[model samples]
Each structure stands twice: as C-alpha cells, then as structure tokens.
Target: MITQEKYRTTVKELLANGTIKMAIGYRPGSTPDRRRPLFIRTSEEADQLVLDSTCITNLSGYLVTEGLLSDEKQVGIFLRPEGIRSINILAAEYQLNVDQIVIFGFDSTGREVRPLQGRNAGDFSALLTEIKENPPLTSKEPLLERVEKMNAKERFDFWQEEFSRCIKCYACRQACPMCYCRRCIVDSNQPQWINTSSHTLGNFEWNVVRAFHLSGRCVQCGNCDRACPVNIPLRLINQRMAKEVVDGFDHFAGLSPTQEPVLASFKKDDTETFIL
Candidate 1:
C-alpha cells in the first residue's frame, strides 16, 4: 500500500507538474475514527494529502457543489465508478458542465485512463444481468413486480415507517454523489418542495421524491447508506434504479462518462411495450 507520506509527496509533484490546479484527496484524521477530504490549494498543503478506506464520502458530491473550487477553473475528481455515475447523471440533468471537469480517475486495477469507472470495464452489467433472472425479493420477472405488489398507499405507509427514524439531517442527499444543485428543490424556500419539519410525512416525501429523481441514473455506490446516521437502506432505491436503467436503456452511469444518458438519448428501438 502507498504510505501516507508518499501520498502527500505525490500530490506535491502533481501540483508542480499536472494541469490540475487543485487535488481533492484525503488526510488521516486526528484519530482513527476520522479522515476528511483534504483540499490542497498550494504545494505546502500537498503534504497533507492521504487516501484510505475511511475516506468514505463520495468525493464527486463536491464536484459541482463545493468540489469545484471555482467556475473559472478546471477540476479533476479522483473517481472510481461511483463518482463517474453521479457526475454523468449530473451532466445529463444539466447540474454539471462536463467540459469543466477532468477525469483523473483510475481503475481498481490502476489500468489506463478513460472516462467513467475505467475505459475498459463494463457496468458490472453482467452482474446485474445475472441477478435479473433471480432477483432478491422473489422468483419474479422483475423485482419491481414484487415491489409494485404494494399499492401506492401501502408504499407510502411503508416508506413512512422505514424513514420514521430519519433525523432530516440530509446525510443521504449530502452523501449522494449525484445530488448536486446549487439549491435542491426540497431546500428552496420560494416553492418549498417539501416541508422543513422533520416529521414522518416530510421525510417520506423527500426520500421518495429524491429516489424517484435518481431512478434512471444512480450507480449503486451505497455512499448514502454509509452516510446515513440511522442506516437507511437508500441503496435499495439506487440498486433498483441501476437495474431499471440497465434493463430499459442498456446504459449504466459511471461505467463510462463518454456514453450518453439513457433518458437524455434514446433510440427508436427503445422498449415501449409495458408488461402490464
């Protein structure tokens, strides 16, 4: 494994040599329990850059948000797969301008560079395909078959019960790499998409709406679940969306940023026969 000191040294060298103005890496927290993203603006702070498992928050969440140091500058995200999908979804949603971001991302194997996850890897689409035939819920054609078995009222009630423990901390949204907006619809005061109170209804409404918005783009990074204070399985919705985006569009975000979004670009042959 790369030593922390060596990692910092690498950042310094990159600062002197690379086109990147800022490198968003991580540093060992004061203790074992904390490791936060280190924003190195100068060569001196390059010594602070570190990377570890505890560097858990999806770094891409900051891309269009705080991630971008400024609009006039270019930024690079140290992505794996999760960040790619989120940024791709953001680009498709017009939340991000793709040209402004650079892909300093590498593969799990540290292979050659390309867009999204890696240039060569598939969406693990084969993995989703293998599971599609035998989904977790039941022996159904689609897991949604089992999911939809519950009526809207039942679905609403179920989410209410599931998110009842929510603290309205926005940890899920904050951790979501794809949840980038100067101001989220939920946070807008003029329209107030959802109430600010941390009541059950408000939580449920926000959760469901956000999940639906991410339906065709989420890459199942599971950062939101990891970030959750109460451990909500928000990835269920993301995994559900990933499966749907693949099944419907044969496209998966994060697999390749160069590829177009399924919703934004469609073919004449795209499916229209509802199995209902």
Candidate 2:
C-alpha cells in the first residue's frame, strides 16, 4: 500500500521539477471518510495529496473542462484504471493530445493502494487488455434483474416512474465526462429537440436521449448514476446499451486511444440488417 507521505513526495518532486504545471489529485473532504478532488499548483501544496478507496471520482473528467487545458501545457493527473480508460476515450475522440497529460496511476485493490506503472494512458494497454480478457465480477443488482424480467410495457412504466422524479437539474450531464457538449440538444430553444421542462414526457425524453448519446461512448464509471439525486438507475440503462453495442457493432468503449468511436467510423464490409 502506498502511504500518503510517499504520494506527496512524488507530487512535490513533479511540481518542483516543472514536470507538470498542475497536479489533479484528492484531499480529505468535509466528512472523515469522504475525499474530494484537490488541485496542487505548488510543491508546498503537495502534502494534501491522498490516494485511497475514497479517491474514486474519475479525475479524467477534469481534463476536458473548458479553459482547464487551454494553456496546451502538460498537466499531471492521478488516475485509477477507469480514469485511464477515460483518457484513452478522450484521446481517441481527439479531445486532447495524450502527450500533454501525465498520469500518476494508482488503484485501490481492496484496502491497499497499489501504484500502477504508466506514464501515459497508452502505457497501460496491457493492463486494459488483461481487464478485457478477464472482466471483473459484476454482482447482479436485484433491481436491474427485476426490470429485465419485466415485459416491455412493464419496463416502460418502471422507467417512467423512475424518470418522473427527475428535477431536470442536469447534474447527471454535468458529472459525465463524455457529456462535454457546449450546447446540448435540450438546450436548443430555437428548435427544441427535447422539452426543457421536468414533466413526465420531458423527463422520459431527457433520460432516453442521455442514454442514447452515451451508448457507444460511456466508460461505465457510474458518474451519472452517482450524480443523480433521485437515485435513478442510470447504470442499468447504460449497461443495456453497452451490451447492445457490443452485440451489434462488436465494439467496446474506452479500450484504446487509437480506436475510433464505434458510431463515427464506417466500413464497406459492415452489415446493414436494419436498412431493409
């Protein structure tokens, strides 16, 4: 397990050596057990760096914020395995140059903080490959299973009930790293694609559009799920769409920096069963 002292030493050295202009890591939050994102600008601030199971916010989301990387200078970020994968997806989508980012990778295996070997996201290709080959055990959520067992009409009613509670706060979108659009379709009042209100129909449209937009791009980090205040099962919808993309397009999201987005690329050899 990597201690906080060791983590701070590494960050301090990086900042002092000018390897990175800023270091995005974690610090103790308001609650004792909670951790929040911490930005380190100087070596003196490095002592605040912390790495543990509580450091679970996908820090890669910060990489693409407007004006955050505008300087085009190198920035260091503390990343878990999923955050590394998000970097790959970001690179693949041409959101940022991979070389401009340095990854201080770490993973919490049970209670131990294990440092990952990688300077950049691509360096962890083998680790990602291993994850792909031997996927993690997904404990079945009874609620998801129950929804899956329902008939189409019953499932619709279930989601409608769930979405009805949405306040249209857009917290889910704001938390998602992939929902980086400057102007979401719902926000287009000139020709509103989706209702901006939080009524039942509007909520349904908002959630469906959100899920579809994330179909082939979602990293499955459950950021949206965690961000939703109403406890909507956003992960289940994302998982179902992810499985459909895998079965239909034979593509998985966020595996490599060079891999093209599943929906953006086309080949002549591609099948068109839905084209009639």
Candidate 3:
C-alpha cells in the first residue's frame, strides 16, 4: 500500500508544485471498465489521481502531441514495466530527449504495497534487493520455452489464426506509447500501404508492419494486447520480437535512458540471409 501510495502522492506533489507542466496518469473514466488519461496541472487536479488494476492506458501515449511541451520544461512520468519499455524506445529513437523526463517506478504487491524492513532502506535499496533476489516476472525466460514447445509451422499458423480475428480498430496502435507517427503508413494517401478495409490481407499487413517496426524496440508491456477490442493476443508479437532481438543481436532491455534505440541503427556486420 505504501509503494502505490508513494507513487500517487509524489505525483500529486510534483503537480502541486508546478514543477511539471503536466502530470499524466489514469483515473476511473466514464465507465467501470474504462479509464481515461488524467492530466493534472494543479494540486486539486493531482489529488484526483488514483492507482489500481484499472490503470492500463500508457501515459506515454500522450507525450507525442503537437506543441505538447516547451523544450525548456521537463516532464515527469509514472511508469509501469511496459511504460518504461516505451521510454526505452523513445529514448533510442531520439524522438524525445531523455534528460527532460523523470521516471517514477513502482512494483505492485499483487494489489497493494508491501512494507520493506520497516521502511529500513530507502525505496531504491529496497527495490534493488528485491530485484536482485527475485527476477522480474516480465523476463523473456518463459517465452522462449513456449516458442520451442511449438513447431515453426504451428507458430506461424497460430498467429495467422489469432490475428485473423482482428477488427483493425487500430486500438493496438493507439495504446502504444511508442507509435507516435503523425501520419501512419496505413493512412497515407500517396500510396496505400494497406487497404483501409478490414480484409485479412490488410490486417496481416498492418500487424506485420507494426511488428517489424517494433522489432528490437518493443518493450513487451502488453498494452496493445489489452487495448485490442477484439481481444487479440498482441503480446505474442512483442514476445516474438523481444526473442528475435535477443537471439539476433544479443541485446536485451534498454536500461540506460541515454542509449540509442538499437533497431533503428545497423552495424556493418549485421546478418542478411534474406537480402540477396
């Protein structure tokens, strides 16, 4: 309870101080299952912020607006594991300056915060010890086995079947905090990359483009999967892409805020079996 409250309170303080131009988070929206982005610019507004299982929309998704912020001002973010992954992608792509943002990381204790050593060590130490002792549940260790358990053909056919149910609502793209392109390829009129119709080919092309674009950059946060109105298991794409990045480039999580997004750059010795 303390950790979750810490995140909520600190965010409220920053908003009250006017330190951040705006603090974006989630509160219960118009309906029970819906949660809207709560942008708090005042202490009273900040007080309205809440954290719970219903918080799913990536706050980073709002960071990509036109005239979003003054370059001179800094932004503070409340990050879950997946939100942090979005930060990694943004940092690597050079789309946003990492130095201008502050991150607040919290671990859910299955619902509430657990007291660590009577609050003995500070949050950082407590987090470090917990992290060192027990690995993150989001780690890709379980994914590789699930992949190996299935044959190649089964895997391919599996995705085709799952993605075939797609309604092409573009919720996956909208929920993604990293997909900030002003004019998506699908919407481009110069030459349509994929038809706007909800055809299988269009859906496949859209998903393929999304996956290939995210390749090494995906953080595997599962927001896209959650956002799918049709309930597609879109995290499979994230998991597969993460596995590919690990297997192909030996690169894993983007821990450093200053590190370049890896998939955007190519090394001279990169493998290219399909090139010829």
Candidate 1: where is the Cα deviation over 4 Å?
A: 3-7, 66-72, 91-158, 189-193, 267-269, 273-276
Clashing pairs in 2: none
* Tens-digit per-residue lDDT, 1-276, candidate 2: 355677788778888888788989998999978888899998777877778877878888898988878888889999887788889889998898899899998887677887889788789999988876765654335766788899999998999999999999999999988888888989898888888889999999999999999988886787888789998888788878877887778777888899889889977888887886
lDDT of 3 by residue, 133-163 (tens): 4536664457556866889898777767777
Number of the candidate with higher TM-score, 1 or 2? 2
Q: How accurate locally, in lDDT, is each candidate?
A: 0.64, 0.85, 0.67
| Candidate 2: worst-modelled 10 consecutive residues by lDDT | 132-141
Badly placed stretches (over 4 Å) of model 2 are 1-3, 139-141
* lDDT per residue as tens, model 1, 1-276: 354455456556656776567777667777885777777868887766655445545677776666464555656555554555566666666666766665444333232223223211234334334434454342223544555688988876766777898889998888777776667888888878797788988888888888887777776666788789997767776677767777878665644345566666779888879857
Candidate 3 error regions (>4 Å): 4-9, 30-34, 114-156, 271-276
Against the correct fold, how does model 2 do in TM-score? 0.94
lDDT score, candidate 3: 0.67
Please give the lDDT score at residue 231 for candidate 3.
79
Q: Model 3, 143: alpha-carbon shift in Å? A: 8.4
What TM-score, over all chains together, does every model reach?
Answer: 0.72, 0.94, 0.80
Candidate 1: C-alpha lDDT:
0.64
Whose TM-score is greatest here?
Answer: 2
Per lDDT, what order, best first?
2, 3, 1
